[model samples]
Target: MDKNELIQKYFEKSLSPEEAAMFENLLADKEFADEVAFQKKIKKVITHEERATLKDKLRTFENQKTSTDKWWYAAASVFVLLGTAIWFMGQKPDYDTLYASYYETYPNVIAPVVRNNNDTITDTEKAFAYYEKQDYNKALEIFQTIIRTSPQEEYAQFYSAISYMELAKFSEASKILSGTNWSKKYADDAIWYLALLELKTDNPDASRKFLLEASKTSRYQKESLELLKKLD
Candidate 1:
């Protein structure tokens, strides 16, 4: 059998045992070996079904009168393979799974609702009530009011950011989380949540930075270090 015929049959996966032996012998020639290497490169970019079509077209091209046509086809195949490799390399990390694995809304720690107490409930308690019920919009409304009245209310600021995050208002959440002076109560907690917010927004680098800082804190150090390893 002709060398080109054997190579085509090999690629098409239709080679008999005898033809495979002939194909192996052809690989001893330097030019034939290089051609096989070129075919291997194209193989990496195509599916198994497409490989059959590729081999057929290569065989047909070689049968034509001009050697230049075969050279051009190989060149085009390399171009396409390189383009495919670049595209796969540029694909972003999977954010959805990462976010889902790590995300949980912050709990209502600042205010505990007493169902039948004689004392009047404050605005902070009302907001935390809404937060525990997962009514983030209403909770945020009351939190904003508290922050306006008392700028140093750390609990209001932290939960406001948490409410924004629950509403998928990443920009607002990031603004509050980034600007707030996290008290000892919420220092590592705030930093850890900020890392998660960045991960949700597909900002892995920013998430990694926050995780690194969180790793230095007491509360979230172990979790932050583990998440940092996953990012790397």
Candidate 2:
């Protein structure tokens, strides 16, 4: 059978055992595979168009009817379309879109240490201002300086990791997030950022795993569950 016939039979779901076998064999060919995929997409478009047309006709009929009775038809159409839209969303959730929807910049809360009794602002203070203003390049430089001076400061470490993320250095960000010396105070934030970094790095399995583990803790449980629902 030709590709068109096989596609039609497949859509109709009435292919005989022998014909179905032949159709499967044809799908192995790139041209045939492309045709089938194109046909499926076109079918989806046509189905939506036809549904909209039917809805318009129903609306027109409802307009012609008495005002009290017309509401039933309108309500029915709304419910049907709503159900279809929800089904479509479930059938094709874009992971990248979902990630963006859930992701937000981590807020900075730590103030720079006082260098002296005078009113002089230090490099760490400048870095905090830059970070607050979203000046990531300057923040990264100042953060590096602070890390050098006080390598044990967990707040500086976490913010420096976020600076790396803002500068698109995800591997560096992951390294800081995976650091053992960070106190438990930053543990939840670290896990969340690690999950986000994994997603950015195109490692969905690792991202899912991180999210699952983080979900056990209350801090990110709600968000992790929502993201996991989309992933599943």
Candidate 3:
């Protein structure tokens, strides 16, 4: 397939292993490098914009909470009384309810491509597959194991941060991504994610700062530019 077809298939996650290998090899070719760069930029901007819009809507809901009707408060009070009664009667708060609540609060992050040399590729691939399928808990288990086994693996670190982000664990994601020991490839990605996390948390200033730093590097220049434009 041609370069554009290869890129389209890659974005669709439909490329065969051989096709993927060929695409990776083409990253070295200067002529088609611009196309790859553009794709990454577009992906970042689209994801960031979608998430930012959600954040704005969430903020609006939070701001308008005080204006909710009396019936809403009455319903909440009834629920709370029922919950307290259940607690007093020694019945556990339902595990399924808790799990569902947690899932609602924290969505899963997109999984990263795992490297074969630093850890067990099969396990990493399994975790990534689970993440892709939106089975966040299983993916988190594998990511935690990878970090425990190889704390210095930047690929694992990056993905771990993403997992936290997906779960809306912004503070945890920020903490992991803020570290200085990441590989160049992972570091670039981390910076971009960090900027998005800041934006999600309503700290546009910090987001802009992180984006500015990311814009200096060729790897993230296009995305950073697009994000900066949005902030303006």
Candidate 4:
């Protein structure tokens, strides 16, 4: 088959075993891989544009004159919800797929790395710089040291859990995140990541429970709701 045919089948996810092998080989070519990445970005842009257009039309419809419009607006809202449910129903992904979809590394918000001429950065700041650079092993080492010295440092503990998660040390991450006495600032993050960890570990029931709790208060409220729909 031609490369175009392989790419089309890939996007449709209908590749036969032989076509799948061909697709994998094609990905080894830089030009083919760039084409795939470009297609992905184009698809994302189109999806966002379509969603924005739908929302704009819905807003316009709701702003139409009179109490009579309320009934139509209500019907339209129900139709949108049912359509979303049907879409999710057809896209029931496995736990690993769902985890990959939702898991992003937690950012280094606690300490923004500031460059200076002198070598005067603190351990916490240095650790966060490593974390931002995706050097999880070194970051975990420093964070563990900080926790040992000041056990009450919740921010250090929080980032340590993140580092563990990055290293796929799920048990260690779970232990720290599930511990009591997280500060209010990191409590919601811990809950949300615990949900992702459970999903990664293939415990969907536990993941659902944590996601439900996170939906109540985390910054991931919309994501939690959407993931719950997928689980359903």
Candidate 5:
């Protein structure tokens, strides 16, 4: 059979065994292989061009101002959706990108207990100073020591988790956040950060749960809902 006919049969997966074997033999020729590849690419380009042209026609029909314009709009919307699906199919899984999109340093709300001299500076002050300087390792050290003495120091506990998160120690961060009471001032923040950390750690199910919990809080409802939509 001719190359075109054989190619058509190949695409339809309807070639007889003999024809299929012959096609493969023909494709062994470098020139024949190049032709087949060129034909396949052209088909793709033509299909995409046809979609674009049809979409333009649909848009023009929608602009004609008629009772049927709603149908035209709906038709055009299908092409838009198909385009989006195509784009999504071509996209790489990007956990890091998603994490960066939502991850930020949790804000400092700890009141400084000392200001006058270094000798009087509380561990909280030293830790927070390190935290502000983005020396999260040093901050984590101080925060851990302080939380030992002030077990109910919610801010210390919370920021220590933030330090762990900054160090990419997601399990440690999640543990600290999970152990703390949710009614504390950082509850909403903990839920949100934990959700994001879950995403970073490749735990989508847990991430979704945390996002759902965060969504319940009025402060994070809209944002968490948006993130949940992206996950789905």
Candidate 6:
């Protein structure tokens, strides 16, 4: 069978044992092998496109605090300045009122940092310490606990995923990270690992999808974007 037919049959799991053997033999041909690789890439792009909407939602929620804080300052300053200018131009003094209004609507912006009350040192710190000591199993245990107890804890999940990847269990790492519903903090990082797993597993399509999703977040945005560019 041709490369197209072989690939289709492979995906469908409909290839007979003889056909499968023949397909494997065809992989020895450089042109046929390249075609298989190209199909994998296409699959990645398609998967990534499917998750685009979810990725956008995650980004929106994750950046809400930063975006809100930035705009709050800008709007408040503009309102206060405009009010002062108006007062100075012989209009009624409204600077105080405008400032009050702005203050009431927009409190101070404080970025939320993830804190783990369950541990002495932070989970990330502990995980790294264990990792540096070459106690990967211990590090993996701590990271896994953090993930199970506090899935939203970005650094812990990131470290855990890294540990799994380091152990060469890409599928396990990907399974732990795929469709994760945590805040934007570790989501992108997880996506990055998932992409790497897909690449390692020879699933270019899945890798492309993950890279695309990761590109939407600020954490891995630059790297993901660059990867996508290179792929193109």
Ten consecutive residues with minimal summed lDDT in candidate 5?
110-119
Q: Best by lDDT, which number?
A: 4
- In candidate 5, what are the lDDT values of residues 1-232, reduced to their tens digit? 6675686678668999999999999988997787678546545654676578677867776777577567867676778878986798577557788889888898777744445554677777788889989999999999999888888777788899999999989889989988878565778899999899989988776776687678768998777776765664
lDDT of 1 by residue, 101-142 (tens): 888888776786434476887898889889999999999999
Ranking by lDDT: 4, 5, 1, 2, 3, 6
lDDT of 3 by residue, 110-189 (tens): 33533456655576788788777877668878888988997765566677777787777889889988965777656777
Better of 1 and 4 by lDDT: 4
- lDDT, residue 7, model 4: 66
Give the poorly placed runs of model 1, Cα more than 4 Å off. Answer: 1-92, 113-116
**TM-scores for candidates 1 onward, in order:** 0.58, 0.59, 0.47, 0.59, 0.64, 0.42
* Model 2 C-alpha lDDT per residue in residues 1-232, reported as the tens digit of each score: 5555566678779999999999989889997888677556545755676578777878786878798878887778778877876787668457667767877888766663444567888776788889989999899888888889988766778888988988888888988888646567988888888888887777766776677667768899888766755554
What local lDDT score does residue 124 receive in model 4, on the 0 to 100 scale? Answer: 86
User: Global CA lDDT of candidate 6, please?
Assistant: 0.62
The alpha-carbon RMSD values of the candidates against the true structure, listed in the order shown, are 19.9, 13.0, 20.0, 16.2, 16.5, 21.1
> Can you give the lDDT of residue 72 in candidate 3?
74
> For model 6, which pairs clash?
43-205, 44-205, 48-209
Candidate 6, residues 93-168, lDDT tens digits: the string is 3323332222211111111244355556676666666776767779889878877888766656656666676676
Q: What TM-score does candidate 4 get on C-alpha atoms?
A: 0.59
Clashes of 1: 0
Q: Which segments of candidate 3 are over 4 A away from where they belong?
A: 1-121
| Number of the top TM-score candidate | 5
Query: In model 5, which residue pairs have backbone atoms overlapping below 3 Å?
Result: none
lDDT, model 5: 0.79
TM-score rank order: 5, 4, 2, 1, 3, 6
